[model samples]
Target: MSSTANISTRTPDQLGASRAKAADNSTGKTPGPHRSKHRRLWWTTLAVGVVAVIVNVPWFNALIVSFKSDGDISRGALALGHPTTDHYANSLGAAGYDFPRFFLNSGMIALGAVALVLLIAVPSTYAAIRLGFGGRFIMNASSALRLLPAIFFAVPYFLLMSNLGLLDTVPGLILANTFLNLPLAIILLGAGFRDVPIELEEAAQVDGASTYRILYSVLLPILAPTLVAVSVLVFIFSWNDYLFALVLSSSNATPITLGAANFVTSTGIRWGDISAATVLSTLPPVLFAVFAQRFLVSGLSAGAVKG
Candidate 1:
């Protein structure tokens, strides 16, 4: 009884020390959660850095080649030999490349296409979501149409535009690009539209506001961010279009994407000029995306899709 009482009376520190000694003697180690966590963090950071490098390699190579001369490119693709601005000068069409004009042509077509897409898609999406009887069918049909590649429409559209005397013109490119953007615009803008409360729309209707009035006065203000998102997407789509521009237009409507092919002359591929043009051509969309990022954040923060 006395021994048991003494054991029970032992201080907590002594008991803890005994248990620690026993544990050390038995296993000689303990695995810490923090050590494993640190290891995982290190590996995750390394993987992210590696992925970023891989993704940027082509753009980095383009950047390096843009500053280099044609001779330097021949020496090595990754090598940074003496850099010069002559490629940019030549590609800018001062030396007869027509880069500026093609860039302007791309902008006009992309912006015009965005306008046409909005003009058609906005009303159509509104009607489909709010007023149309067969909204699901309309949306499903749009999705089905998207599955049909834009290339499938190219030859037929070329013939149709040619018949209308719109071939090889900016208007021709605008019309084709608009068609290309419609499905995407409808789907995206429609998602935003669906989030709007039907109650407000009903109230406006009860007050005798016309359909167009409620759409413009009440809903559009709330949908500004979403509208910006759709506009940017449509602009980028038209801006980056190559196949349609290549198949439909020849000279006056050549976008930068198609015009980039001009560097493949009979004398051999002009690598430096091509690189310079690529860098220039990529700038607008990149800049636009950068600028529009604020709107994207604002829109998402403003509202979300409802069940």
Candidate 2:
């Protein structure tokens, strides 16, 4: 029969190898290489889990302290023996605290900054990457700005804001955060732009699409995930900014970062109140990340491979 002839045509070495493989499979023995690979994977997972727990211990303690009473916190015990909502109530409803206003200010400023950064960074990065307009200059300037500490610009920004009557105002904080976040947005978007294929633009142009049309209609859709990632990062950075908030705003424009300082009085640091405020301040960014996590992971991994 044809099957018998095909089997007899196999080389001796191939037959021996196939029989050995079958024997190993029948005996339920894994190949050495596969077993070693699984072992390495297991060890790697365990190591990462250990490291994650170590890093999160302080944050876990802070969460516990947020729900503890003042006396319980002062006792230096992480246990929530008598869990209470008094800290949350004080942080939210206390007259001098005004955390709701702080939350509002932070949201407004962070959103405004994100809007400005994406508005400017998107077009400019496209121009630099595709059109070769100020490519080196944009890259170098942004890189240099990244190298310099933000405090370096604090004096000039304060003076400029004061002269423009923008001090202690939401607009002033928005502008400051926009400036701080611009370089990072540009760098991130630049990478995404570079990863895009130029042939797509050429084809779009052949179809009578203008440069703006190609960028908006073609490239923008492709870069949507990266854009969302950049927006989230800029929003978080703007939300958590403290130095500019400390120096530039006093009362009217204070974000949560500055507002949290209200818990630190001349008497002493209110650990319970501070922890509660800290927990409250982190909610927006955490929720933002959770919602955008899908796009965030994809966008960050965009350039990892090539088709």
In lDDT terms, which candidate is top? 2
Point out where model 2 deviates above 4 Å.
1-47, 94-96, 288-307
Off by over 4 Å in 1: 1-32, 288-307
- Scored by TM-score, the top model is 1
Q: What are the models' TM-scores?
A: 0.82, 0.79
- Each model's C-alpha lDDT? 0.79, 0.80
lDDT for each residue of candidate 2 in 158-181, tens digit (9 for 90 to 100): 999999999999999999999998
Global local distance difference test of model 1: 0.79
Tens digit of lDDT per residue, candidate 1, span 189-252? 7777887889999999999999999999999998886788778877888999989899888888
Q: Following a full C-alpha superposition, what root-mean-square deviation does model 2 have from the true structure? A: 10.5
